[model samples]
Target: MTSTAIAIAAGGGGDVVAASVLAQRLRHRFDVVAIMSYSWDRLIVDPTPGPRGLGDFDGLTSHHELVAQVTVSTVLRGPGRSTLPPLAHYVGCPLLLMDPVGGVAGLAAQFGAASRVFGAQTLLVVDVGGDILAEGTEAGLRSPLADSMSLAAAVRSGLGLHLLVAGLGLDGELTPPELTSLLQRHGATEVAELGAADVTRFAEVWNWHPSEASGLLCVAADGWRGRVETQRDALIDITDDATIVYEVDAYGVAANSLAANLIATTSLADAEQRVRTRRGYSDIDIERDRVPALARHDEWTPAADTVGAIDRYAYAAANRGVNALTIRRVLELAGASGAGAATRLRELLKCERPHNMRPPLYLA
Candidate 1:
């Protein structure tokens, strides 16, 4: 087999998109590049909370002897859903499904197995925003479990690890200056910057990916400079730094982050418990509580005056500080759901100069 390199997305689907962009760049360094990504998606996209495991999926192909490759046809076994299948089909590379159900040791074993099977010399753990480097004190930090787990697992995996932080502050979890300070503390070096060509490779996928942070990365790469309004009315600035990817000291980051304390976690529950105990909250808890409440009132029917409804939703969202929303969220706000919702949303947004909005992302 040809020489291979693996890039691990440090979060969920958004990180997977970021990994794909980085993996494409890695193709120049290795004959083959594969991405390992978590199945955790936002509530709007998956509905089912938490990351899905290997057994949760239906059409996964065995990768070599150990890993499972998510294909275009893969689907969740039941109520759970996945964006990995569509992502696999479009990313144009082997997209491996990484189940973090077993926590750090399990993840480490998976990492080692993939490295051995593919003869990979180095593992690149990529985070879209710099939250993986956060020390759990940033005011904006919301999701840190997955990123910290990946960092700890990769450190224990015993592979030559390279840490990359891309699209700084795009996730709205950490600001550019915050991440830059963390990077500087860890002695991270600036690597390559992603250009339009890199964004173009995945632009079509962006139309339906429902990954806000990744979409922001592409928009930033496309030279859009302004404040990007996201979920909860949080604002992310589109700056030149969003285009750069930094390679940091892997061991130093692991040693300093919440990952260090989580290194021995043998189960996901244990890891979540550790994070909650330290940070006073966990992201899974937030998802678990929020998803059901939203289900109660998230449904919306397209009003007879569709334009008026769109305008109302836009105005309401902005008043709440949200000027941009993911396609899934847009569908929810419009009270549209099921198979025809996306098409219906396309029609609804058209009257609002949706051309300015990217697919999967509506610039409200």
Candidate 2:
């Protein structure tokens, strides 16, 4: 079988970490290529003398070794023009742009053969923030959500696709049922929830590097293990601020696990409680509120608007036997497929007019 050429579009350190883990797991089946759209240099640089910059890239060493040789590129130019790197410049084979929120599909289409080779299988992972959605327009491409939904619908019409939502933060009130319903509405056929244990397993399989092996020992000795055990139960009931903290701390521990003295030992419950308490402080909350929005949906209405665009396109495509895919098809392939939320969103707007007040179909 021909090797799948996969492209990962990562923005932050966390994104890079996730992509690296995925690359390691699929190395045998794929020729993985990573396209980083943000600058790690700026994120890490700090004027202060003590431990400056954000931190080293997590899993950098392992990524260099186990995964297909990784490549890093910045999407933005300086602090202004937020456009991503032209996707036309990177096309060579079947491609999948991870989190191509900022108009990457349009750019990819410009590559002609690359876009056709990937076809409806071209996928993008959508997050709550919608950064991928925003980048679509910024890069002069159609909305990523629209393209994703179209692809999903097409896949559903033909092959049996499945969806699996893994590594969802356990700190929020979002339930498996809720997620399943949402995915189903968008055209998914399955939906599964993953927990901390699953995450740990993924990390191990990826052979992540340890920054401070000794710090992990210190954390274990400092009762971190007991704390973590106690917090496991709390993780299930997480709905408020406490749970959020627990989730963040858990993520931090997971990220810093490479440090010998910094092993994450705190129970999910205690970590949650600590995070809640910390957030309670006026200064902390105030500072956190200042953090810039990472996803485009937080500010732009394009993603939401594109939901209708996708529905219209799907309906038209179905009528014409175009074999278009929708979000549901993509999720089905991922394993945690369902479309309850997407269906409801469409229904709710059934009677509403399109934002531009333009007819659903356009003719040249």
Candidate 3:
């Protein structure tokens, strides 16, 4: 039997970075295949052309071949511009949409069947944060924990058949107790602080971090403005407002997944209030100051808004489409389930207004 392996790098630059790092490592042992939900177009590029943009995964490693298969639509618009159509039609193999909401599952399953022609597995990864244990009224839809559990259940039983939880970082330094509690609540069997080296070791596993080079793509809103020159130096291709939104959005989504409520702000004051009231911490810390900047700058934005960014970045990768059979191999190992598990999982995956979301941010 071919020792096939799959690695899913979810979220912003960090996910990509983790993917890259892991890809290099896996190349040594197994046929390292990757499923990039967003930002592959921007990450993998020919940097020799010159200075372009940040998060450019150019010339990072020569060992592994990076394959692009699926693409997720930006969350900024409705069905017309959303990624659902193209992703549903083009993916063609055991399809795994990172977060497969209600209408998207049937299509995902269809693709899965097509992929099975060549032998593959389909999987999905969802970030629920800390909103799971609430009432299922409209208000609960926004609950992070509930949302994650719901999505996990849906994929577990649905066409996707495999699910993984992404973005579970705690705001401040997580005490051991807090980490244990967080893990127990999420039903995760293992957790690790991701770094460059870990990527290679877990490259063959269904659940592993992306490459560190991928993390280069992440830019905080505040850092983008201040570090524009630095970013320009790092990336191989730089254009007018090259899509930096994906990193911001991914980071925001990941942050929201851990917090109790939806962290949002139209202005700096709103951000401060959200942090103060929800997180219950003084805004005097260095990291706290960084949060506002990350939100305000171009690279960082609220997770809900960052959907557009991820779409723009994935445009090219989606066009290429990787080997569907390889994706199926990865999904089989993920071991995710579907909707029959609970009512809470179904409710969380539905789209709803952000304000109605729950848990309130807990400031560090």
Candidate 4:
């Protein structure tokens, strides 16, 4: 068998997209590449708080009875939705499922099994944004559980984990300066930039996938600059750094993350509880509380009311200390959905994708 490299997208959706790029970047080093990712997605997609397990999906192919490969036909067992099936269909690679429901130890076992099954020696853990390096004390950190669990599990897997951080501040979780400081603390081993050609590999996915972070990364790789707004109206700077991927010492960075404390958790709940018990807040709890409110506020908004809707959502986000929300989210708040909402929003705002929002909306 040819040498295989396993690239695990620390989180799903955009991370998986980034992982695909990284795998291609490393093509010369390995004869084959296998992609892996968590099933966790935004509340708008999965409607769930945490990552889904193998049991939550159907039509998955068992891989050595250790992990399962997600296919285009794979569907969530319930009413929930996912980007995985569509990603599997578009990426045309071995999209493997990572069930974080088992927590860090369980995740470590899966990593070990996947490595052995694929006969891979080089293992990469890819995090789209640098939130994986958060110490859990950063003011902007909103999602840390999934990335931390990935870090903890990768380190515990005993497979020599190589941690890659792409789109440093694209997620709007850790700012560029904050992420840079953390990388300095961990001592990044390599820093390389991706160009326009690198992004074209999966640009088609950006058309429909709501992964603003990954989209921003691709835009940056394509040489776009300036601030772009995302969920909560947070404006991310799409600088050259956004296109640069950093490979840092996994163990060193893990020590600075909540990963060090989560290596023993038995379930995603246990992991979330541990974070809340120690940090006083959890993203899962925040989601559990926010989704119900979003579901109840579904009133159709007319064109004349769109401005008023934007003002209301922007004001709320400001009060929460978040800078901005994506145009898509603002439209969603205006009771917009389906395919044409984005086009209508662009027409209303007179702006285009990756450039619509120039200056920051909610200034800090």
User: Which candidate number has the best TM-score?
Assistant: 1
After superposition, candidate 4 runs with Cα above 4 Å error: 1-3, 30-32, 297-325, 332-364
> lDDT of each structure?
0.79, 0.25, 0.27, 0.74
**Residues 5-85 of candidate 4: C-alpha lDDT, one tens digit per residue:** 688888777888888877776666554357889888766556666778888988999986767999999998874577898
Put down candidate 3 lDDT per residue, 1-364, tens digits, no spaces: 3233333333322343333443343345333333334321111111121111112322221221222133333221211122222332322221222322221232233234333432434332322122222222222122122232223223322332323332222111232354345445444432222332443332322112112222222221112211111111121221122112111122223333422232222222333344345445322233434433333232221344332432332343334431111111111112111112111221331233223211110000
- Superposed on all Cα atoms, the candidates' RMSDs to the truth, in angstroms, are 3.0, 24.5, 20.8, 4.7
Candidate 4 structure, TM-score to reference:
0.85
Q: Better model by TM-score, 1 or 2?
A: 1
In model 2, state the lDDT of residue 352: 53
Per-candidate TM equals 0.90, 0.29, 0.30, 0.85
Each prediction's number of clashing residue pairs: 2, 77, 55, 7
Candidate 1 lDDT over 300-361, as tens digits, reads 44567766766677777667656466665566556554334445566667656566466656
For candidate 1, the 10 contiguous residues with the lowest summed lDDT are: 335-344
Ranking by lDDT: 1, 4, 3, 2
Q: Name every residue pair that clashes in candidate 1.
A: 233-321, 300-335
lDDT of 2 by residue, 168-261 (tens): 3221224445434433344432222222332342232111111111112122222222111011122121112111100111122122211111
- Give candidate 1 regions above 4 Å deviation: 1-3, 30-32, 297-299, 312-347, 351-353
Error of 3 at 268 (Å): 29
- The parts of candidate 2 lying over 4 Å away from their true place are 9-13, 35-164, 169-173, 183-364
